[model samples]
Target chain A: MNILLRHRIILPVVSLAVLLAATFYMQPRAMSYFGLNLLFNLAVPIALATIAQMMIIMVNDIDLSLGTFVSLAACVTATFLNDAPILGLAILLALILSYALLGAMIHAFELPAIVVTLGMSFVWGGLALFILPLPGGVSPGWLRALMTVKPPFAPMAVVAPIIIAAVTHLLIVRSGIGTVLRGVGGNARSVQRAGWPVIWLKALAYGLAGLFGVLAGMALVGLTTSADANIALRYTLLSIAGVILGGGEFTGGKVSPAGAVIGALTLTLAASFLSFMRLSPDWQIGAQGAILILVLTARLIFSRKGAGT
Target chain B: MTNSMMLFSAAGLALIAGLAEADTSGKRIALSNNYAGNSWRQAMLETFESTGKQAVADGVVAAADAYTTSENQATEQAAQIQNMILQGYDAIILNAASPTALNGAVKEACDAGVTVVSFDGIVTEPCAWRIAVDFAAMGREEVDYLATRLPDGGNLLEIRGLAGVFVDDEISKGIHEGVAEHSQFDIVGSVHGDWAQDVAQKAVAGILPSLPDIVGVVTQGGDGYGTAQAFRAADRPTPLIVLGNRQDELKWWAEQRDANGYETLSLSIAPGVASLAFWVAQQVLDGEDVAKELTVPFLKITQDTLDEALATTPEGSVANVTYSLEDAQQVIASAR
Candidate 1:
């Protein structure tokens, strides 16, 4: 239990610290308030996305469609939320309900989450395409104002990650509902014996995941000031990688919202850092992958050392 | 003088000189496009549909059918082409998903006596006629305009298009080549805009604090307005922002021209060139000899022409000029 706890928090903190130090050393300006904002400006959406992925992982399920779902939400947010508020709100609510139904269906039918989501990605993407056939839409005035709000003390970019991580950590790690969701992942049989509906818990987790996905999509659209069906497509793999990089396991009810945010930040910073270093865009992706592998290896080593003790 | 304008005028003459060589009246034309995710593709489709209808009115072709696939898969596009062949289209104007992935289908269409012409994002099939603007020249022209605007050396911030794309690489190469000639200019910063307005705005916003005084900004299509917005939002003096052919950008440029006395050139691959492919197909069907490859000049819009483009351009649509048959003949002749 001690090893598990340490791995959950300590590994990600260490990795984040190391990355921060390296970035500051290479580009001192990144330490400034404005510089930090520029570096982390896009991290809020990514953090929300990682948390969404974390919720699904807590239920020991994966969502291959999370990225496209986020994109769909952005499409909805950009078009409906701006033009027809009532209709847009109704559609978004229906989307959340559909996610809950999807979870229930997955549990009842004994479907693999991967296959279900993989198929659903097309549905979500096609829906987004139907809504916004082209990559042009006006972001709602309020959302844009919210995204660009510059706090007096620090840029919202820097503050957003912390708030997102804290709130998600509290809800998913500290709350009683969170424990039930994780319990479902750990052992549905026991949870069922305890007179709890396993399917309900699973559905609840999926609903929460959908909520966060919507928030992520909206935040991204707010920042970018427009929406496209394929805009957030890169988030699918990135969110999964963030969860894993934060010491979350693929199996068991082992996931950390805080760690996932840190992992996302680490990854975002790595890209920005590389850009500041003036590396070719061709080399940036490879370099970011290398960083991921190195961090994972170090985490593995540290876990092994703790296990030996 | 813009070389393209000069070249275009010369081509216009050739087209007028060669107008009587072909008459295409009853050919069925089909437009097969790979994606419609961006304004560029949407504008291209609209242009093709409208121009094809015009061709029908002029007895240039019998029917013009357009098909667009949202999925950016080569197989999907190739399948669409095969179905078009099966549908008995006399000619297929294609904007391919890949450079070579559609070769097999294109070859089949050609073997079946179908005239195939690809434009914008074109194909590499030996049997198809390809129409494309010289992207390198566009890039070079962007820098050349910058050089003339800022004769003395100044820092240039290059907002590149999507990373790892062939067009992106080609344009970037051309920009570098153009910059190499002007000893006074230096590119101090670069970022990928992904050819989207909002993406470019966010990226430019992020990098602005880190960059020194930027004298000018160079970008591919779909991002110029966003770059200008970033500058305006940052309260920085708006530099010379080279524009692509989006109506939004052109409109914004006209506004800036009036308000801030801003002046800059606008250049883009007229999405209407898809219609050029249709016209080419018509010529081929009329038994006129056409080249396997055709290079079309990018439309260069100056202050004098900017208003005309904006006036005719529909709101929220890209500004564009279609090629007349006379102009089309000139384009075909330039290949030789």
Candidate 2:
């Protein structure tokens, strides 16, 4: 039991399973391929956003600007990426570089990530509004087709998350560079002592986060086929919730790519389950909050029990 | 011309067109609403449900279920619309999250032979029929009323809605145009209220400290009561504020009238426009020659009708008028 509890992924996996079971019980149709596809299609961008948040969290820093940054990326994808591909790609690359520079600045100046990102949130939101002031821009065709692809065995919704989890897990959990990056988050002093450049590691983490954020935004526009300045503003809170739900802590490097993916899926399913129950809209949002609290409480109880033994 | 004149002409055409015998008993309709966070939206959902129940009982349709997204996000609403399509709803009445972001899902629903009718936050897809309020006219009329009330106008403060939204842009444009035409009133200050009372109060308070004595406040709907509150808090003489048809706004206006004979105009698109969209979707499904674009008249309350509107509107809700099938047909005829 202690070993199982110590395994960070188990809690998120169990929580996801329980929620999926409840959803299936309530609406058996959700078990089919088509129904599952419909239920989970929007989860793709959410999972990507969660993973992006996880990358920032892995470095023990919070990003309040992630939601607006994603919105800006989507705006870029819908406008520049559609009409002028080269300019769009260059802008996206510049955005990622800016994120890396931001990380470097934070580390060098010993600034609070929260305050910096909070200020940047407004900048990103303004830029997004400037890019697509009114919510009207056609997504590029290839991107749209890529997002809606249908494989034979499982739907793209399920397949996409699996691929995301697997690749991120391999890159962050198995590689040598992964060890150095985690070391920077776990103990920057010790990593610097060992001759690993802590500043570069933090920059790398933030740059990776930017990459995922861009992907999340592009995926969102592909699904909606257009962009709005405020389209993904809710993602900041959702991504933070996803990270915490997946057994990641606030001031530590402990994070699980698989657990975060499951957490995103669980959050998405919770919404689908509530819609299936057909609760009043007034209660629906409250019920969703209740579900989140229940899952977290269960995790707390199990962790306490595990510690006692 | 005023909306009443158009309605009178359309009523005659509707009677001559004769759309009473259409057969739509087997079709199922669904309301896909994006947000229900405010009093206005709550009133909208309630109106839709009550009107749907009546329609169902009269055998006008098989079902009229309403679904609102938890998060007011385009992605969530698109998914909801797709689910409605899968559930075999013959028609969908939508209050979209964004005008353009939901085009893909709406197009898919259209391809599946589902009739889509969008109102309030209407979609931009050509396949969907739109029931839009002439929001620009609503804004322009507010200034026009203020011009009549304060012929030699002083400084005015403009309270706008959520930024980056098309509705906000349109209304603000109209207000600016009205100012351009009137030339007496100068908009000295402007702030975004996000069409919420508390937000409006806070925004107005933030900007009022620097402005000169204002004679009027121009506002989008859902912000009038808040603007009044801010003026009271600032201890400034209350301005002749244009109001949205919220119960609280009307009630405040009434109290002010009793105390000081404050006369101002109140107008808003009725929350029951959802029912109009519903009936239009039904007409489309019933094989009626409904035009792709239709406009609903905004409800207006003047000093004379203030008491009547207040008595009819529920507390903490928006003023509303449920549209019957005849009203929908009249609107459709007028559009044609």
**Top candidate when judged by DockQ against the true structure:** 2
Instruction: Write model 2 residue lDDT over B178-261, tens digit each, in one string.
Output: 999899999999999999999999999999999999999999988999999999999999999999998889999999999999
RMSD per model, one decimal:
24.0, 6.0
Clashing pairs in 2: none
Model 1: residues with Cα > 4 Å off, grouped in runs: B1-336
Error of 1 at A23 (Å): 1.7
- For model 1, the local distance difference test gives 0.81
Residue A19 accuracy (lDDT) in model 2: 87
Write the residue-wise lDDT of candidate 1 on A169-202 in tens digits: 7887788988888888888899999999989988
What's the true lDDT of residue B271 in model 2?
A: 88
Identify the candidate with maximal lDDT: 2
Looking at model 1, residue B18 earns an lDDT score of 57
Report lDDT per candidate.
0.81, 0.88
Residue pairs in steric clash, candidate 1?
none
